[model samples]
Target: MNRKTLVLSAVIGLLAPVLAGCGDSDGGSDGGDAIVVGTTDQYAATKDAPAPLDPAAAYDIGTWNILRQTVQTLMQIPRGGGAPVPEAASKCGFTDRENQSYRCTLREGLQFANGDPITAEDVKYSIQRTQDIKAASGVYALMGNVDALETNGDSEIIFHLKSSDATFPYKLSTPVAGIVSSKLYPKNKVRDGFEIDGSGPYTFKADVKDDTIVQATFTRNPNYKGDRNIQNDKVELRSFKDSDSMGKALDSADIDVMTRAMSPQQVQKMLRSPKDGIQLTELPGLEIRFLGFDTDAPAAKEKAVRQAVAYTIDRGDLISKVYDGMAEPLYSIIPSNVATHTNSFFNKYGDRDLAKAESTLSDASINTPVKLTLHYTSDHYGAGTQKEFETLRDQLNSSGLFDVSIKGEEWKNFRPNQIDGDYEVYGMGWFPDFPDPENYIVPFLDADNTLNSPYTNNTLRGQLIPQSRREADRSAATKTFGKIQDIVADDVPVLPLWQGKTYVASHDDIAGVEWAVNSSAELSLWELRRGSSAPAA
Candidate 1:
């Protein structure tokens, strides 16, 4: 991993009473045998659940987190940020000078939880099945360049690509590339239920849901042959509706740890006054939040109107007032710390100049008081989203150059509508599946992107991206990324708003905060442990 690992440097100044622990109670010296964690409800409800736990079908963060721990992949992301290292495979790398052919040799004696031998054929079958399904939301698009997979004996496997893709190995580090037992999964269709046979560190024990909560339990797999050390015998994951409820649970010691979906206000409050018995660890800023425009929309079709919208909004105020400085203003789709990230948008539209916006609109013959409706999810981006959009509405309307109205929807409904191009303009957030600049560039620029926007720049889609993919030297590839950012800045298909920092609030006695956050900015539950000093509930 490239970034330095974050650790619990200080305990909460204030002290609170410890409570009796709940759930499994096999031991008390190390805070008990089971650890309970809480997150937002977004993780629990699956819009497509009846289907099997197919690694190919798991797209969202919540499902991917679970799959990453339960299923093995060719390569795995390091704890901090850096290039992926081999996981199930003993070693994997490009074998041809063209950067189109890759090979992997698996470690011997690997087995699934059910005792099925893990072989090179299993790896080939897993990749083939995912590509064969061609699911709309699956990782097929990322692996589009892969032409064939061949296995030699039971240990060596080769992947031939249609074109050079230097980022292909990074794709192997994602949950979508999880290798499954061919004996357990079907080749033609998705699995019908959650019967998963994996070769990772954890085994799925049970998943249950009710009206108010969804819970999943996992146990350490005896067959696991990986680097991760499972500290707890079992881990229980619980999901709540919002941060407030989850915060209440944390206060009462109902949950040992809480990660993701906490409101900015809650995080700020915790930062100001440390609550006794709880410690907050702020992770690196690797996430980006932006507003995407539907290019087909009548108002957005004009490039001047889009540029005007971008120029009129103030990111400085949004960060200080709305986000409480928890985030930094973003000028590009790629986050700042990443290589090749440029401040293209900020260079073009400096300090939110209303005069420039007005001139752009006037030059394009776009009428004054341009009407636009901004769509956002009230439930998804935490409680601050409503105020964030409201602030945006105020900024645009105060300029006297536009008339803006805002609408709210839940994430489930909001995502589909945005993907279907139902909203003219909408707010969206992105967490990288892999820690690379290509991960930031390809998803939005690809012709078959999830944005569903009508805007298509063939130069970017066909030429520049492929050119960058062939360049193995990342530093050398920065020039191509710079050009791509300039194009995106000029087009204004999406306006980068801010990059977010990850936070994890855990009981003071809980250990391994540093290892819990992986390179991709996702929580790694297997790394969590309880200190011996923690009192058992």
Candidate 2:
């Protein structure tokens, strides 16, 4: 069977979490075998379900996390951390010719939990559906370069692209390309509150109200002749409104696993106490917490002024004090452990050189004291963000060159205002779309940058990225992205502040631990196992 992969354009719509389920004891004469997972997000899912368990339409990371339990992608970077492996597809590789086209032959007998056979047509339908609804779908942006999706036969699908992109396969592995049932999805646009059909290891059993969700044991699909990474028989996910309550849930054993939002202070406390029946797992996260400047602001438009502000703020101090050692000092937009990341910004800025900042401002002759307003999100990121910003204000104000005022808003209004150029400066963070240089470069550097921060650099868009992706050799990809990073260091439209270090606390009963650096940095539900008996207490 010759497997072919193709790109399709489409928009994915995400609905809030509807009302959320399940039971089967893992061992003993009693019967409560399901592994219970808890999260701190206040999810609002719908009661009735829809067809087309499509990953494209779903946008929120939380929703995608749950969908992964029920749907399989072509490849997944194992949650336990390792190279990407085949999941739904049995054997997948690129064409030796042209280097642009790719193919993935499906494993024979792969069927949805609902018993529908998964075929190449399903993959084609999933890709084409996103293209069909591109205008309204936020996900269409990810598939901008997809040209055609051609299926060779029943088992094989071939993807032909406008250009050769090494990262294309990685994109296919994301939730955005999750296959949907062609027969179930409507030909027209899906409304906001629509339900979805899914084909993964587990099936949705009952849809309760705001109380909780219940799932049931997923009989192994005989057709599931795919990857062997998943090892769990069933899973139960319960949602909470915040981290404190979720922590209490874990304490009471209301849930067996808790990887919910934990405050830095709480994480520090957990790390200190080895006897808390909680284990903390830390991984390099593909997240960059940043301070963004509104380039339109008169003071911000000047390079020296921006450089001055960058210098006055101390990253190491912030990490030690504000983040409680939970974050790593960051100088590049791309996290340090990833490919193409360099300390170019650090080389230019030096170690909190306040004098250099003053000297830079002195050279710019920006004698006119410039007052700037800095905005931040109160709920998002961690709790110490406000103190971090206050420290920034103090440093800049003490320079006697800047007059600073700080304000904060909830995430809802904060995002729109930043997009609209509402404030002089603000804080933001990024979780990669996929773990590649293109993900770091394309979204923020492209001339048509989606964040709309006016970071239009033709050299980055027209030359740097294209030059990188066209290379047949993977090693050569770094040069182009490296140049883009250098440009970012010089331009300084957005100052990289710190790299997020992901921390998870789970009960000793939970085993088969796994995680990765990208946005979906959680234990893969399929691999989680509850101990046969109560943990040693």
Candidate 3:
């Protein structure tokens, strides 16, 4: 959820008003037949940000959650983890041994909700628009390997890559590559409002206020033709300002499902006593949180200073104190479940050694009590984040190895300044672009990485990442990934913190809660449906 905005959100100037839940729009959609879901996500538009729903412009998971209902990509990740399968396409694969060229044949007779035939040209146009608009927050960077997009007749499209990239099919599964009608969307700019033109499982419509979507409704698309089985006749996505409101909405049956931004305290409470008609499901998570440094900034420029901070702070404390023991300590940027994951950070620093931290600074001839400010986003992560950073500050300050101060800002201003290199150190959370170890390594270390930090590793970016991507069987890249993690630990550019577990709370009558989200962290609302009669509100 946070990862999508890491690159695109810097332009989001002011945090939009919190989600105003289904005030009165229920009308007739809240019967035993319809479903309502609540979330804490809000979209704000400034002079720089494109409309949040345009697939070409939106890089956010929340925005993509809404788009996935209406927009179809050429390929889609299945309900569970596995290789991506055809969604809009009839068949797709690399046509060459080098993995540099690929082709896809479109499903015949695929039509948009408005009844426009979706041709191969439309697929090329939708993807090319992302590159053409050139929004700073857009996923144009993900398509960096593409040399050209070619269309044949009306059913086939081909992508010619600049280099071998076996992960290209995984890229096609993301909504960033969502296909749209060529005629309705602008060729060089994002669509200006909350509207979608695609051939997915559902059709979307919404009411906007102050440039943010206030209410959204999705209905089964009558013209839809895809792999998914639509679960309900109608679904309403409501927005809440905080977890408290979202929790109350679930309790009162104002919303049937709650997800994405619940507080850790609330989750722990829910686990203890899940209330009378509510059930909580713990889905496997790939979400991770960590500290990223602006290596060019004076506060962390010196290697010894970064190393000292790493050695002084404790990651386990962040879980026990801040998260109420809800997350697992992350020893490397790559989560432990990933293949080739080693405790590089733990091996290098060895569990908060104060004497070692002090000696590293002293050995470099650097001054004691290093002054630095750690920055975090006020809204994006969750309610516990401010306390998380405060705990980090307390750990470093208590060690007497550094003078640490903390700064908190809402997602709007926080992202831009982080992008501009205004903060010395900042907090970030990531869900993978695809369910692969390479997604974790390349995004923060590469030139086109989403962080916008000045940290650089030519070997990892140019050689290691490319080498991993070229291996068609992902499991065989273990040695290369092993070397990459070691370098990340040695460089101390990004300090691994914790890996989070996903908690989705819903009414007891709701079905498909477990199947609604996949390992990639994409929310598939179409998988959800009303199993029994819900309370009449």
lDDT string for model 3 (1-537, tens) is: 101011111111111111111111111124345688888877666555647778776776678788888889899776555677899998999999999999999998999998889899988988888877765563676777888999999999999999899888878987778888777888887887777878888888887788777668888888888888777777888877778998888877888888878899988888776566666666546788999998998879899998998898888777899887468889899887666678999989987899999999999999878899999998777788899999999999998778999999877678767777788899998887776777787778887677776788889887998898788877678788889999999888999899987777777667666667544456788877676333221
Q: What is candidate 3's local distance difference test score?
A: 0.78
lDDT of 1 by residue, 12-120 (tens): 1111111122222122123247788888846423453444356876565666777877999989866544567888999999998889999999987888888889899
Best prediction by lDDT: 3
Misplaced by over 4 Å in model 3 are 1-33, 532-537
Q: Rank the candidates by TM-score, best first.
A: 3, 1, 2
Candidate 2, run of 10 with poorest lDDT = 12-21
Higher-ranked by TM-score: 2 or 3: 3
Better of 1 and 2 by lDDT: 1
- In candidate 2, what are the lDDT values of residues 399-466, reduced to their tens digit? 67689999988654565577677777898877666656577667666644545676677787777777
Backbone collisions counted per model: 5, 40, 1
Pairs with backbone N, CA or C atoms under 3 Å apart (clashes), candidate 1: 1-81, 2-81, 20-537, 21-537, 52-191
Tell me the lDDT of model 1 at 276: 60
Error of 2 at 71 (Å): 2.8
TM-score between model 2 and native: 0.81
